[model samples]
Target: MEGGGGGGQELSTDNVKGIVLALLSSGFIGASFIIKKKGLRRAAVASGIRAGVGGYSYLLEPLWWVGMITMIVGEVANFVAYAFAPAVLVTPLGALSIIVSAGTFYPE
Candidate 1:
């Protein structure tokens, strides 16, 4: 598909880099979610209160903090990818990332 108002511009090297970055972002984000869940579970076990039940104990978990930082880095990577590539190319990669993450880590 041709991009709008660009005289049929094709994908460039930067677009390739963007795609790679987006994929890496997806991986990091997916892993971070898993890590954060583990931290939440640990916090709940230690405090005898689930985060869903208004527990703030997870905030003190170092693993949770690491996961949050991983997510932030992922987001930053995604943002940079967008800057280097078109939305049409980037959006599908994001969706694929979510699908892959779900398929890889989804509970039965």
Candidate 2:
């Protein structure tokens, strides 16, 4: 419905931007979890301590920090997206994160 006279459902640019941001958030946040885990694995191997065992070696890993930063950016993007679009449209998008994160986090 491209008609301008009355009721025509159209996606505003803000909604589109919000959708994009939400998708990016899912991707970044999803990948960050795996990346951080990968970093922790490397740190544990190199430093002789697993993060799960109270080891802080992951803190020294640049890759882990990168994952942290990516997570933060994803969260920020998710927050900002709310300002551009309704929660109804934004909230369900989080489900995408599970799909995006699940496969990668347990990579074979």
Candidate 3:
């Protein structure tokens, strides 16, 4: 669920395309997160420095920095994926972001 920057009843053609793109983008993003989480865990084990969370924030931890960088990289990767793949294939794949984000935020 991206591009919720505004409220509206109807989306313009461009908006429709953007929503489609964003959905596709999210899938790539979700996969990136999984890869990042594994890498973060490995690094923490190797370096003996674990990430911590507190005070409504994740704090200044290595995993936090890695997550931030992964977000940026994932956005870039999604653009690349869209460039190569058709929107139909990409949209559903990209939607993994919504499910992943929802699970993280509203865990079972």
Candidate 4:
């Protein structure tokens, strides 16, 4: 907790915590999607199946499962962030994940 010697609120400790948590949530979820996509691509190449074409081969992929678990953890952080801040703040921050995902893309 940070203290303001002057008698005015500079951002309470909860809000600061919420902001950090929200950012972490967005980053994790964004990176997770990219990872999941890569995993699916690898699985498809190995199994002669494409998830986009309704293939379930990703279910057998450990990388895909890792991405899934990462996504779940990110979602948990997002939910916890909501507990410390208003949705007005958290919802807009959620868009950072889209930015993160876009940055993570490659033309491969």
lDDT of each: 0.84, 0.86, 0.59, 0.89
Model 2 spans > 4 angstroms off: 1-8, 105-108
lDDT of 1 by residue, 1-108 (tens): 645776776769999999998998888888788878888988998999999989999999999999899889988988999998888887778765566456665342
Which wins on TM-score, candidate 2 or candidate 3?
Answer: 2
Off by over 4 Å in 3: 1-28, 31-59, 104-108
Q: Per-residue alpha-carbon lDDT of model 3 for 28-76, expressed as tens digits?
A: 5665576456555655656566554212233334655666676777687
lDDT of 1 at 45: 89
Q: By summed lDDT, which 10 consecutive residues of candidate 4 come out lowest?
A: 1-10
- In model 3, the clashing pairs are 24-94, 27-94
User: What's the count of clashing pairs in each model shown?
Assistant: 0, 0, 2, 0
Kindly state the number of residue pairs that clash in model 1: 0
Model 3, position 65: C-alpha lDDT score: 60
- Alpha-carbon lDDT of model 4: 0.89
